[model samples]
Target chain A: MIKLTYRDAVRRALADALRADENVIFFGEDVAEAGGVFKVTPGLYEEFGGERVMDTPISEEAFIGAALGAAITGMRPVAELMFADFVPVAMDQIANQIAKYRYMSGGQFIVPLTIRAAQGAGAGFGTQHSQCVESWLLNIPGIKIVVPGTVKDMYGLLRTAIDDNNPVIVLEHKVLYNYAEEIDEAELTHVPLGKAAVRRVGKDITVVATQLMMHRSLDAAERLAGEGIDCEVIDLRTMIPLDEETILESIAKTGRLVIVEEAPHAGGWGADIAALAADKGIYWLDAPVKRVNMGGALIAYSPPLEDEVVPNVSRIADAIRAVMRA
Target chain B: MTQNGIALPAQMRQDMLKKMLEIRAAEERIQGLFLENLVRGTTHLCIGQEACSVGVAAVLQPGDTMTCTYRGHGHALAMGMTMKALMAEMMGKASGACKGKGGSMHMTDASIGLLGANAIVGAQLPIAVGAALTSRLKKTGNITVTFFGEGAANIGAFHESLNLAAIWKLPVLFICENNLYGEYSVWSKTTPVRDIAVRASSYGIPGIVVDGQDAECVYHEVSAMAERARRGEGPALIELKTYRFRGHSRTDQAPYRPKGELEEWLKRDPILILKERMIADGQLDETEFEELRESIDRQVVEVVEWAKTEPYPPVEALYEDIYYEG
Candidate 1:
């Protein structure tokens, strides 16, 4: 068993990919010598050299588009956008071009591209810097959305993303990078896209969480367990081809559902999943599916204001209790 | 190589003029069809900009790649994409290059190395740079050309793609078809610079401005640049000074263009200059020119009729091309 931080797991995945394939390359602003602003790509430039790991100009659209073009021509390119907020500048290329190429071209072309961006609100980065914009990307079709909550999922899902013959958006929670977990190196296997993992199984209430919220959900589950409320927790590793079956099965077993998310409550992936449950798994629910999500506002710079904006373990616990009571 | 103008062979000159006239006449026909509502959807006619496409395309090898913007019918046609395919694409028929899914803005024919056309301004620049990079990496000896307008020169993509091309010495020709307008707006009102070509010098590469109304002048410069690219000498920035005679799309007469400027540019009509010069040089007589026009007209009519007879894409095609075979 190897103990690694979420960031280390990601670094390991990238290292493995670079070592395994010569065509795999990476480029982004301050990604080379700086080893990525978040240190997710640390030591890669030294091992692979500039030809494989390059520092690009501050042009998100171009570098991302370059990644797409490279991927189409048999290179597995991992493009790092400094922040998730900057992804909007390259949305047309990602959403309109990368996502639609395989389908639009009738399978004549394949975009084996992976776009990695640091997401979530932490470190007091103001409104612009602090945003959980994974929901926006989730709305786009034809691309897989991978949101890794743990070091294990980070290592596994990223490897799977690089290998997938489709465009994949890997949204890393900024807050979870330093979070450590002991994982078996051999067992730290690549998880298939669209599959969810049952983090903590229970029968009282089902808690669906992703990214940072998954940790919070687990904490809430422990707190609820002390209060004699056995809450089932499911980590939605991939959001797009969401493991609806796992979520609905948990809901069916528990007969209660509480969805937790760090992004704003309105129009988040939680709502999409809740709608799916409402429309398809209505008979399986014991009560109305409760959604414990961040308040509708931008994540503020001040610690207090930021704390007020995002959902916490207490809120999730309260939501699960409310759903259990109902 | 100097930025000074180069001489053109008589044969090459005649061919350039003929290509320019073909694009000019075809664009005029497209405009007529659009105005009569026969060509459904929006059409970005490159009427006065024939010299740009003809000039750049004249330099390309059969296997070289090219990418363009929404105003790409001229590029596609000049690169030998059949008028039938383009017209069928405009008419939303299965015979279209992308089988009617791409429409006008997303035309693609990878068989001829026409990678694709993007509607987003400056988007294709990076893709072209990447394509050139791939060619160099694989030692394919094939170059890539991307066409954009003067407005795109100021975009972050233009700077990034150009810098990458220059730094890597990639065989990329950044063809700026400076048509004075981006959509219904004029670049003079938006851009601070008088000439977009001047910006290329900042990237440590040669930037040249050619008379976009004279096809032979534009062609000679592009041919030299293409030759330079084949020798791995590096990328070039060629700005073709031209004007858009039609509206940005099918509708909306451009109210932004000044009356005197429009009339002055119209006086330098590329088709007329080519026709007159060809007759004056005795390379083509009036009778031969008239016969050629009739032949082209007949070809256009036949293509449109053939396209009309083709069936629309099946409904199942919607789910067909979204991913490659696993």
Candidate 2:
């Protein structure tokens, strides 16, 4: 067991993957010598050498597309997008090419491609650099998405993503990069995707969240535990192959649900969760599901303005309380 | 080596000639099927650009992989995909290359080394670069060829992919088939440079231009570059000055073309150029050319008939191919 930050754990997972397989390679802007824009992949270049670890030009479409092509040709490439906000610039390659390559190729290609990007609000990177855009890819099939909130999930899910025979995008929240925890190093290897982690178990209300919201939801659960309202917090580890079973089971136990997300309510993944609870888990619900999402605005440069839109601990707790009252 | 290209054995020349004819036949037949409402959705055809496809594929061996735009039936056929698979894919039959899922814009047959074709402009450039990255990392001694148009050179992916391939010295050939028009707009209007290959200097790599109508010229340049890349000499951008015979897609008459442009281009039709050269070299006769065309046309028609009997993929198939279960 060792104490490590979320960033260090992610770097550890990458080192493990490189050590485990010669086919595993890494590349992105400043990923080689500079570690990464977030300094999450430092020392990998020196450890693995330039052939396996490279620094690509700031061309998301090229590197992302290269990841797909390289995966098809049998090399596992871990590409970094720098910031999730930059995804739009290469949306064509990410959405059309990487996401559809396997299906379009008649299941003939095995794409063991992993793309990691720094996501969510922190460091005052503003709208173009701080948005949590994982929802932008939910509609695009043939992609597996994982957003890890803790050091454990970061290491576990990333190891799994590198080994999985598909394209997986690991959205690492910028705010959580420095989040520290003591974890058993051996236990964090190859955590299965499509499964949710029950962060805190309770019977009053279920709080479903992921990434930055996952941490806030856990905070809400702990704070609410003092008030007699017990919240069951479920951290959705994988986004695309959603762990609906866990959400449903938790909802069945609690009979009340509050969904927290960094994206706006409009066209967000939370809507899908709400619809899922309504359609499949309605019988268990004692109250309508309350969604705590970005307050219908873009993430601004100012921290206060950004806070108004980003779902936080207080907002999550409020939603849980409102659901409990109902 | 001849003035036109590397002098090849009789078998190789015959194969190139036949493949070019088959690509032309297939493109023409697809248009007819579209008019008859047989091929659903839409399709982009590479009719007059058979030489460009044939020339590139002719030099590549079985281990070499390729990716191209939606107008890649020519590339597919040249890469050894059967007429039945190509035509059946557009028809969305169960026997289609993508099992009737990808429809017309995406066609992939990996067994023949074709990664797939993408519908979006400039999306496949980075994918081929990825494949090249694989070759470099794995020391596979194989190359990847990606075909795009003049318009793609202007997109960020093109420059990004070129720079990515350049710095790493990845074994990739960026084949830009400059067909004058990127949809409705002329190349000159969209691109500042007269020669797309000249832009390769920005990445400090060699860029060569070839007369796309002459299959031998494209073959010569691609083969040379492929060899150079296989020798670990890094990537190169090759521009083939070609033209498409038809409008982009769906009922487009290409009224955007200037006066006499079509007629002038028609005189240099890739198939005609190859046919004239083959005849002058006494490698082919009028009867052989006629017989080959008739045979290819027959195969094209036969595939449509075969597809008529083939059903669409079962409804359950929709749930499949979306993810790799393992």
Chain B TM-scores across candidates: 0.93, 0.96
Candidate 1 Cα errors over 4 Å, as ranges: A103-108, B1-18, B253-267
Task: Compute the lDDT of residue B3 as modeled in candidate 2.
Answer: 36
Fnat per predicted structure, each in turn: 0.47, 0.86
DockQ-based CAPRI category assigned to the predicted complex of candidate 2: medium
lDDT of 1 by residue, B264-294 (tens): 9888877766677767777778887777777
lDDT of every model, 2 decimals: 0.83, 0.86
Candidates' interface RMSDs, in order? 1.7, 1.2
Write the residue-wise lDDT of candidate 2 on B1-326 in tens digits: 12364566767778888888888777788888888899888888888898899989988987889889888888888888887787778888779888887777788888888888888888888888888887877788999999998988888888888998998898889999999999899988987889999899999999998888888788888889999999999999899988988998878999999889999999998888778877888898999999888987897788788887888888888787667877
Candidate 2 chain B has its poorest 10 consecutive residues by lDDT at: B1-10
Give candidate 2's TM-score: 0.95
Model 1 residue A17 lDDT score: 88
Q: What fraction of the true interface contacts does model 1 reproduce? A: 0.47
